[model samples]
Target chain A: DAGVTQSPTHLIKTRGQQVTLRCSPISGHKSVSWYQQVLGQGPQFIFQYYEKEERGRGNFPDRFSARQFPNYSSELNVNALLLGDSALYLCASSLRHRGETQYFGPGTRLLVL
Target chain B: DQQVKQNSPSLSVQEGRISILNCDYTNSMFDYFLWYKKYPAEGPTFLISISSIKDKNEDGRFTVFLNKSAKHLSLHIVPSQPGDSAVYFCAAPDTSGTYKYIFGTGTRLKVLA
Candidate 1:
């Protein structure tokens, strides 16, 4: 009954550093997706995983990567973080990878300085 | 180029009045559309969605109307409440077999009490 959950509610990292954010999908959910939302902007798609496989990826650079686990949890890794990378990292889950309503978590706020 | 756009950056409406938020998309291949509501320092929450085949979908006081011809969609909230004040985003899945979503810039709504 609990919705999707994410860890490190807020994070601060220096430029060129590496960071990993985690997400646990809702109970019975099989798909997990990542998104980034900058200040005063809407969320942008990052990556989507279904059944522990990469189903989709956004226009982010190679520095950004993600993986889904057997338990349907997901981790978003960002290497060589820049000031531009500072944003709210959101994790969403759906019943499947296809067209379905995605439920989101509280999101991890990353501030790169 | 931004595939989805919300021209109005903000909207103010009195409580108990009708609140309307508009969105326009350039991708014709997008078949599914959705709306999300977000508060400060939180992730977006699913609002209402409408498929390309349907012109409208309603949930309680929320209604979404899709116009395929104009590639435009609108969310209508009847008897808007102060609790409804938040940022609204419109989104559609990528048509490139990615299942990733393209979201609008978002419109911030303020419901005056």
Candidate 2:
């Protein structure tokens, strides 16, 4: 089975622009989560969706939002991007357990100038 | 403040030697802990995990240990190989009922052959 898949392997944006990153979970996965990894740092949780609902959210600001589709795919959107927003955006999928191991995707590299 | 921390930035070991990476957390409510490995351009892959109920969980050559009293965890790779070189992160579930995770900065392990 294919693992978690993300689209637009790389992206570039300017300050004040918006970007959207997409992810499709594994064949039988029901939960999807988003994370951001800056260079030299660990991935930080952003949002999580399960069964087409917002199940969890991280410490990100209102500018960041995400939603799950009925088919279990997810999209993470960042508005008014800043230079500081440049990072690798990772999407992870797992079973619907409240807390469990997550399988991650290749991730989208976003660079904001 | 960083709730999860990996003080060691990098480590190098000869192939076939043992590789030990450490992590520490300040949150007492963290009941679940996990370790993940990441290659240069890929996302993190779950390596091993241990719940608060267990002190150690092993799989193949990877082992994870958790200490609730010290709020610490560590991952051990026995007979480390060059293929085992990667960035390792330690993470824990948040207690805010969001199913989110806080991650350590990560430790880069280089197994020299």
Off by over 4 Å in 1: none
Q: Encode model 2's per-residue lDDT on A1-113: one tens digit a residue.
A: 89999999999999999999999999888999999999988888899999999988888899999999989999999999999999999999988837667889999999999
In order, what fnat does every candidate score? Answer: 0.81, 0.87
Cα-based lDDT for every prediction: 0.95, 0.91
> Candidate 2: where are CA atoms >4 Å away?
none
lDDT per residue for candidate 1 within B4-85, as digits (tens), equals 9999999999999999999999989989999999999788999988999999999999999999999999999998999999
The true-versus-predicted C-alpha distance at residue B100 of model 2, in Å, is 0.8
Candidate 1 chain B least-lDDT 10 residues: B93-102
Tens-place lDDT per residue, model 2, B28-99, is: 888889898999889998888898999999999998888888888889999899999999999887887877
